[model samples]
Target: MLQVFRKFFHSSVGVFAALGLIVMLAMAFAAGDVSNMMSSGSITGGDRVAKVGGNTIGTAQLTKQMQQAVEITRQQQPGVTMKSFLAEGGLDLVLDQMIDGEAQMAFGRKVGIVAGKRLIDSELAKIPAFQGAGGKFDQNAYLSVLAQRQMNDADVRDSFARDLVSRQLLAPAQFGAALPQSAVMQYAALLKEHRAGSAAMLPSSAFAPKGLPTQAEVSAWYNSHKAAYTVPERRVIRYARFDESVIKQSSVPSDAEVAARFKANAAQYGASETRKVSQVIVISESMAKDIAAAVAKGESLEAAAKAKGLSVASLGSVSKADLTIKSSAAVAEAAYAAKAGATAGPVKGALGWALVRVDAIDAKPARTLEQVKGEITAALTEEKRKQALAALTEKVNDDFGKGGALSDTAKELGLTMAETPLLVAKTPAGMGLPAELASILPAAFGMDHEGQPQISELVAGKSFVIFDVTKIIPAAPAPLDQISAQVMADIQLEKGSVAARAAAMKLLAAGKKGGDLAAEVAKLGVALPPVQQMNLGREEIMSRGGQIPPAVALFFGMAPGTTKLIPIAGNKGFMAVQLKAITPGAVAANDPLIGQVKGELNNLAAREQGESLRRAIRTEVKVERNESTIKTVTSTLAGGN
Candidate 1:
């Protein structure tokens, strides 16, 4: 238990260190933007968002923490935008985490859990982010990093102190969790248990109405689900692109240039001499001499090795430079001197003594310049184009800095300026953008209308683009007249699914009452698909065949011979499940699996206990929240204001 607590404490401290590094990097990157936003009065004027006991969580502190969290999330999900993060409740999650941390700190202070200045200083010294090139704590590097992030030394020390206090307060809950042997064994057995069951699918298409859906029915369905039919907001962008391929055709290398290139890189166009050799290494010089003598007597190396309880190794085709093994230079020299089928060597090696045999020799072949002219010309052309593109990129960047229009720049540079089709954040296929441009969809769509042009690399560094959004098309529902056919089809599918589910239920009920399921299905004029045997857990069963309906998971806990009706594929079909057999897994009391299960359960219990303790502390201590201030901060961080 003490070991567990020690491990947890170390891991928690490591996490705090990582978070601190992220905070520094994020603050540095977002300093200018955050300063501008704050100056614009985007955030409501308030010194603090919440007060927990005597500890006040200031708005500036919360905003800084939120920025760090956002940066970490961005690293994990490369293309995530602020809007998507807010929609996913990222702000709420960060707020809860901050509040919890403050609650823990407050409780620690009340209980006299103090982190001394000496401990805090020691931790700060050990952080790699604060270290210099020599891998030792450098006060200059530490101060420089803080200055870049607009943070001072006192702010960092305070943060470290709070982290230590929180860890100390939560140590008891994290370390006290333990599981009984019986519970561990039971959980392990449950995880190992496997059940084999069969299911028959009843597709909705089999029960689809022969008649078309009425106009009224289509309209009714459309009215109720208007949001589903709405097209998401999209953007039209105008951009100028430059790549290696865009370099002038006249820039092709001349024959003289190609010849010079080939001459300069002669080794690349010539094949080196290689030898096929076999060797037998032994622990002693006598053993090596005996093996060489055996080979000299026309005995095969393999046979000679077997007689000496050793193995012969084939070096395959290798050049002199490829012989990298210890003492291989002498081995190569001897092997190359020997004629094919000749045996040589009783030479000492790093491992032992060696006997070598030359199997075959391949001579070097030099390629004529004409034979590699095409490759050389292509390389030269690529180099010239890269240089030209770099110059063009620099000019375009200068123009952009001076507020020159992209279209005018494109015209001046003889580059094409084109508008992209209305593109969504995901940029679905058939939008007609080049494959390379597809990668920039997230950046393009995340921009506001008429926002500054962003430069992005495409095809690695070989290509570059400068683009700006030309128009924004807000999301709205399509008119009924435009998608009446699709709406009617959807309505018909829904009705068919309902009918299929009813038929499946009837079959299940009949089977439970000792009636034949297949016969009953046939009576409804529908033929059930053959039963498929599956051994799966709840999640696996639910995800089978693209998307399995939630109802099928009920069979996981059912006994053998139980019958159930389950919807399938999100209203695309229905299924009748008959539990065929259950196989009990044998779990030993002393099994390693039991220990693993116990460890997982203990970790979960510890996390839950920590959460509960935080909640209890929050309730005991008075907490005052400024709701309007939090709203303003949340909006500002989410880029809504």
Candidate 2:
């Protein structure tokens, strides 16, 4: 149990995952603007969202990763926004992670280290994607991956190499072996055990403090932490949030329009240049050459192909434009260069191909409206609907700035305004608030003088065209009226705790003299609960020190049925607890529990190994981050002026 907790808690997975996610985000955010994508020398610049070595992590790639991230983030937090999450440094944290990954990879290359194939295979086997229906590594599936994702053998090798290097460099060094029996015992104790004990709550209304501060102490404390009380400079502006799906609103297209579109694009609906051909495929070049030789010797191509282990097959009724062989550069060049029934070269294809014959050809004809009206209407209607949505968005945002707010504009459009409070500058909570609302939060903090409404033109993904800073709550030290009573109550609690301690030894002496536990406790003039048999484990009772106490460790250490006085650590008074029973546990072999334990142990070991590896590499690796630059950027962003 102790080991599992450690593995989950201390694994370097958080770090590596963090790095990968961050790098992906950097690539996404850095490449946000498409206009600058091609001409920009590299995305490592401030304008760049992410960087790898000197390579610009293109916005296109970043966008893809960001979309994936957005989906994952949305899954985790259905209503997370760019503003609220960023206020808590989510974006910054993500950016840092990405940058760390990029830097680490760059650093890895600087050294003469390469991730080994063994490491790649070991890690690749861990991924569920490579598994078959039975959950084991599937060789066919593995080959299919190479075929499907357009990955050659080299691509797979590179992927494996990177995965291994990163994993080796990243595995956390925090994993511990043999989850210290002591820790496991301690953790297990918390669940099954607790010491029987009692605490008297001194009512705040019954006691008071000495030497009240004249606001000077409060002011001093507040001054020392001035930065906390200081409200960051803010901006007041107008902006509307837009939902990305606004582009899909309703727009009915006319039948005439659909018919016209169908007429204009009739060819795209159905067009084909059909062809008929024959092919001979051999496994080897020598056999293919011999087959070609035989075909040229007055021997039939099919007979020659059969003799050389080649398969003679015909392409039945395939579109010439869609011919697999004709579409291939290598295959097409050889096929087109030959006359009808002429022999072509041993043209190897993506799979493998050789000599071919062109038998016949046929062309397709365009269809009438009766044959394609339904499909045309659907396409035309969709296009019209898309255009209508754009117009709707423009109308909404334009109405917003027409000397009116969203509410007033909404009212004009026969819409209703829904208002909500409890919104923070960084995190705009509520389902009504879009995630994009957060992307402009930094800008919101920069708005000057509240009440002036500023609206967004239109941000992609978000469709709302409005925003306005409603209020600003300046942070200040709590008033004495609000805090003094609480402070006085705290002082009284301390006094009560001291009073309780002053009576412990006296109570202990009386209990030793056969004074009833209930009678003696009552003699103190304090109301207490009846004595109950509480057999708490070491961890359980200790964790509840406030209520039950870890002093129970010492209490349990006492002989069964015997009472012992144990001092409370970092608290008031000693407790006399009577022991009831003790239970011990041992690690079992052949128990299903052992497998779970082993997995935890392995993870712990991996973490500790990764951490150790990182430490060793740390001395040799150099890092130079412009933190001041980053902070300044943050401040500049936060402080609008």
Off by over 4 Å in 2: 1-259, 271-367, 370-382, 395-523, 537-641
385: Cα error in model 1, Å: 9.9
TM-score of each: 0.58, 0.42
Report lDDT per candidate: 0.71, 0.52
lDDT (10s digit) by residue, model 2, range 1-641: 11221232234343223223322333222112121222324433554454444544343443344344554466447786544554676545554434444445555678655667776566546545456766677878766654654545554445345444454456433434456655544444334444444323223222223455445655555456445444443333344344434444455667787777876776776655555668776668888888878877889888887776557788665554455544356666666556666767788865565676766655567677877777777777667765765677667656645755655654444544433343446555333355545555655566564544455544443354555666666555545455665444444555655765655655667656655444566676654445444645554544565674455456665654445566555344456555544555444434454455456665776667765655454334433334443444444444433
Query: What shift in Å separates residue 186 of candidate 2 from its native position after superposition?
Result: 14
lDDT of 2 at 100: 45
lDDT of 1 by residue, 94-174 (tens): 666566655665566778987799987876777665676667889997787677667677766655666666667776777
lDDT for residue 438 in candidate 2, whole number 0-100? 58
